[model samples]
Target: MPKVKRALAVEDLTKIAMYSDPQIAPNEDTYAFVSATVNDDNEYQSQLFLQKINGGEPKQWTFTNAKNSHPRFSPDGKKLVFQSTRSGLSQLWIVPTNGGEAQQLTFFKNGAVNPEWSKDGKYLVFTASLKENDDVGNQHEQTKEERQKEKEQQAKEPIVIDRLKHKSDAHGFHDDKRAQLVLYDVEKATFTQLTVNDTDHGFEDISPDGNLILFSANLDDDADYALTNDLFMLNLATKDVTKLTDGNGSYGNARFSPSGDKIACFGHEYAYSGATLNELYVFDVATKERTCLSSKVDMQLGDVMVGDSRMGYSTEGPVWSLAEDKLFFIGSDHGTTGLYQADLKGNIEVLYKDNNHVFGFSYNGVDNTFILGISTPTNPCNFYQWKNTELTQLTNANAELLEEVSLSEPETITITAEDGSEIQGWLLHPYDFKEDKKYPFVLEIHGGPHAMYGQTFFHELQLLAAKGYVVLYTNPRGSHGYGQEFVNACRENYGNGDYTDLMSAVDYALENYDFIDNDRLGVTGGSYGGFMTNWIVGHTNRFKAAVTQRSICNWLSFYGVSDIGYFFTEWELGKNLLDDPAKLWDFSPLKYAENVETPLLIVHGEQDLRCPIEQGEQLFITLKHLKKEVAFVRFPGANHELSRSGNPEMRIARLNHICGWFEKYL
Candidate 1:
């Protein structure tokens, strides 16, 4: 028998950062990635780190004291280009891959991001904001006059108004301006504007020959309507643009084949559950015919990397290795995310299998080696290089810090649903478990309804399990990593089948785990999970307490309030609000507010445009008016990502409220 650990303190969170998004060098001899580390002040700072494959120490490359990320090697692998905000704005910075003084490349008043070097290493393509009134001579005179006028205006009016969206926890918002493509010539040391106009173009890929550029844009479409994003090709020589893929669906991440004869991309037809099913398609440049590479393969395309001889793609959408016509990817079809290799003929084979989520993978054709970024429930992100079929650690981002903490590994469990479908879940018992004693259990749900909770290190889950609560979470129907059919099970059936799957998970925990107290049950989740929490409290009073974070209680209001509301609701709910308002109200948890008896705590961020605070406010107001036990907690200056990448102070406060609310009610 053992006792649960206490909640994580603010000081403990400063030990290490939960890092993802790994990119390897072209030579495969070294790799660079963004490593986030919490400072003594509890501020999370992301810096670039480089590690060699020869078992040397991992060295921190950048020391700008600001958030630096997205480190990628140049074509020659001599220089590393990245995006940083050390100059008070996020701009492109280039430093030698071996470590040297970094040089700032761009100095626009706006900012630059996503720097990709040309194959010849002569030009750099990036995205930046170019204003309509941007002119060297005219802007210089206008700035001088504006500075004098601003001083005079400030003297007359003491109130200086800020026009921007103020008080953002992350990168603050800006005006609704379009971002254009810009080409920087490394030899000429000059900047050339490639694309301009009111149309916004995003750079995705540059052809290996440097003759064509691939991008996604919303040109010739409704400015307000949420139309499909299309992929287009821009010829560098003539500046001629041609639409490659056109339809009523969004297309992005277009890559050129090694021979530059074909293009591979992944996108969905419409912006709904159908959009979630991303399929990989290839287009022959000369023939102008489209071929679906992942048509027969029922998996969501993650990322596709084309090589000189072959192309590789990930089904779960991380990273893949395509060399010599062999397609090596990471697949999650086996109930867990694992690496797999397949050929162009759709012949698939498992390369590596693990319970944890693989973030990124890279393969070197010259050395015949593969490098991967691996993480699990007990380990943070670390680099693992495969040589001669042996995997070795290349970088230890938080190995020392993790050794100081007592972390519990999650036990994988399978539960039978009402329809007899097996549901997968992971349970974390109290640090010290006593079979004879009853312990409180918290059922945590993940958002995306499309996102799966894998064997990864989750700070919030760890803190909850440490507080003497048996934490049980599962991927109900509509969660990814399973087949497309399983993910779409809750498409229009919101609270029907998915609800049964979640409840069955709780039932299994109670039936099998003897220490879980049935009377002291609690539930909490964000986004779609929040919707489930709201629906669960309304339908049954089995749980003593509940906390819903960034949730939607009413579908009808969410249609108009959310940023993607109009199209997302139409796709998932199967109709717009006008089509059937009754159906929207029927699935709304707030509609059954009168039946809610469990004491609930509603937490939301003020600036969340996804699930706006209005959703939480409506639930709070309705429950308060009904004389039910409920509390509302609003986090100011926070958005929908508050729980994951929000401000350190605010993220800790959010977890504290969840713990406090459950402790008080349960």
Candidate 2:
């Protein structure tokens, strides 16, 4: 008899090295990428690796074991510049490819990040946060001890809030700090502030002529109220700026064309608010006329395949093709992320497509070669070079570890919702499958409400499947990848539309799959998914067990607590908490907590600013007060990203807590 391979365990996933940020060298043959893994400190350790396209073992470039990323190769290929926090703060560092120690390039009060090398390679444009009253020119002169004294004094003072957007999930409390566009001249070793908006200025592509820089900013007085940004071009020589966008829509991810005759950007008119499908647009440099190049393509023009990498979003340019006649970019279909190319005539074609997630990619238009970061259900993530049709694997970060572990593959399924709309989802069978035997089932949901779940390696789901439970997850309405109308259908009607879609998926699975035990069922999710789980338990008792993590219980409270609460409430709910308290109360899961019958588990991260621990606390307390079977588990110092990029031990413990609860109940 053949022996079965060991099923995937949480321990095995914690050991896999997650890869991101693929950078192609100017030489066109070599590229660099970042590989991160959980270290003994229970924190993610990052390092950059260099590899050749032809064929060679990946060579470790930086050994800082710190946060080293955003690698950019100089035009001469003699130097590699990247950002690292080895200096106690995030600072730009550069090193010679041949051999040399990295040298720190900036000493600002707030460190720099996301440095972009210019076409001439003489200047680097980066983003850095600055206090409202801080002086950029004199910040480097202030000593750390002096800064600490000032901070200590400021801590004693009360935080006087004035701005509408005074906090965010990424930038805690805002602190009146604004991220601005700054330019660094490598030759002069000087930093110059370009824009003075109190808000952040996103640094985009630098013009080919090296005379102007493109950026996006909402400089209006009521910028926080309106969720739209306009493109601006700063002339380096004259220190003048030009507004390119009309501010009618939220425009970003701006990239200049090769000839400088056009600009390609991404955005929508907020036609459907949060559910608006990302559209690709082109602006004529001379005519200043904007056109939606992706109007004909029914798909969303962004990479929405959810994964466990913290490399930032992969919504790259509508990058211009080498010939300047076409543009290349990434887009999502049913459940796959594909690299696509579009022409000036609004025609888009898939250059590469498969049942996998392309988290990022770097292409050398001149050489017609590409380095892509891809992952499948069984694969973590690795860099591959697309030379013609063959994609050569350059980095096997998880190959050996995965060889001994068994992973489940998802079977794609489609079900019709109550509204006659088609919903897409995937079903994963237990590792040791027996078609005639009954098995417990778990229904998993994804957050974002805008993020798409697809054929990717999700450690949590695989671990559940390994424990003899069939898993079902789907991309319901308000999720990207589907057409515009489908995603918009969930607006202002969250639980009703999306909830039914999820229920329909479960119904379809229970009726079609013979092995699934209908009586032994469970449900769980995080963020928006967590909110859904809370809503599901309150609305129905179909499942025997449920776990809601970092969920939303009360929209009225959420409107004031969550980092993006104020505006996110208005954008998603279509009304502010004060305008219609009853409306938000009607949609809140806490309002329906009295109807809950299934045993529930509330999990949350203490440091989660996005959803806040209060969300979980409120639900848990309310359920306990009502004498319901509920439990609350909290992770110290963990954030909303606990399941994905949190501490190694905490992630494992969270998974164990979930599996243990389901095991006990189901």
Candidate 3:
């Protein structure tokens, strides 16, 4: 008898393994990576795995129940350093690659992260949070008793805000501590502070000679209002700080060339505000002259494809070739992220690209090999090895679970807007679909009016398809993966071109696919997508049911409530509350809420700072006051990232609510 396959379930996420951050060892033959999966307690647990690129089974290197990621190999390939929460807070730990016990490396009070190895392997540089009066090494990890006392004291203190950017989505309220870099001498067991400032410093890379440390920070007194991040170098011995780039653009991910004579980075001047495409640049260290190497390339020079499955961060870089003449980095174009190569003369060429999503990769300059973290519509995530010109699959992380369950594969689609421009999207058929029956369709929109929805595996979209709904997701005019012109089309023109593009997608699907039911249509989206969902229901009655998540309703209140509202409103809408309140209100969906007739479900995270919960509450209360069909669901302790990296239990509940709403009305 053949094996039976079942439709995917919301709980299946626990069984699915996620792979990321593949780092090739110095030997060029072995590599290390991080694998994560949901535990029985509905918490995500990750560990490091080591394997050989030539041929061998992966060995479980760490057995901790907490997240152990950001693995970096030593220059001699003798040891591996990674950040883990096993010691309570996130801290760096080192373990021998051959096979040995892991040893704790740092014990900072606020924990340490972003570890980088010096060339001689004698010094390890990492970033840690420190107060203005705190010493680097003296502030060891606090004991449980001391931590509880500190927590109680902090709880009694009121948060006093003094800066425009006082809070963030990741860390709720701003504290006195700032991020700084520290050097750990492995031989002497002593720590040396490299930076001291109130503004947070981002660790980029250590030069080959280990004399200068590269970092990015806005040291201006009014950095809270500044939009650019300037690169700087800290001399390890003399403690002298040198500014590199001019104060004109935001630059980061800087790497020193082989000889440390040149520094390559990715950044862009805010010519178009937040929608500006990041370009590649090289700085002549001696003369301090900067040149744009990707001036001709019209693609974003980093992974911009939005996906929920990716967990850890991978260093997408201007990784130098041994000869120091060429550089390699990831670029997003035409709904795909691929590796590209460029030289000093501004010439560029494709290195590796396909229909799959290359979320992360590690390149070895010695033999010119690459270890890639790839994902597709049918596969959550897996590892692949690229040697010479051939590609080989390295790991089948979810093979067993995938074999037991059936998944829907999306078909590429193109829609022509009323103005004759083309919009790209993908459509997935209902599982076990038949041509004779018309199935209800759900239109899914993505956030980041600047982000793109591509070939990556999206669990939420798949869940809708498995529940017998034809799912349609698209990249509208403002989404990335298209050219700069297309992405900037919706800036300051919200609810104009982007709104038409989304409606055009629905029309194209209804006309092209006969299996979709026009009468029982539904729509849903989060963040900007959520904003559109609300806008769609108010502007038209085509959708019978709508689910708006982490949405924005009243632009007037949003201007003061949201974390990014102070600048994002002016940047994206070309209007601020002080400049033109009327224009911002004109683009808001709440202005037309009285026209909504469809049953709408408002979902929001209570702890969300990006699109604060008040955005949803105002819409719900207004709709209720108007006697409109509306329901609100709020997740406690959940932030804007709740749909992606929030509590696993909440993620499942959110998915259930979405499917239930469609089932009741669509």
Best-performing candidate as measured by lDDT = 3
| Candidate ranking (lDDT, best to worst) | 3, 2, 1
lDDT tens readout by residue for model 3, 21-56: 899999888899999888888899999999888788
lDDT, model 1: 0.75
- Once fitted onto the true fold, the runs of candidate 3 whose alpha carbons sit more than 4 angstroms away are none
List candidate 1 stretches off by more than 4 Å: 1-11, 133-176, 271-275, 303-324
Residues 248-356, candidate 1, lDDT per residue (tens digit)?
A: 7787767676667777666777534452677666678777687665666666545221111111121233222444354455655534556666555656566776777
Q: Give the candidate order by descending TM-score.
A: 3, 2, 1
- The C-alpha stretches of model 2 lying farther than 4 A from their native spots are 1-4, 132-155, 309-315
Task: Give the whole-model CA lDDT for all candidates, comma-separated.
Answer: 0.75, 0.85, 0.90
**Global lDDT for candidate 2?**
0.85
lDDT of each residue in 375-491, candidate 2, tens digit only: 898887887888787787887777787778888989999999998989999999999798899999999999988889998888888899999999999999888888887777777
- For all predicted structures, in order, the TM-scores are 0.90, 0.96, 0.99
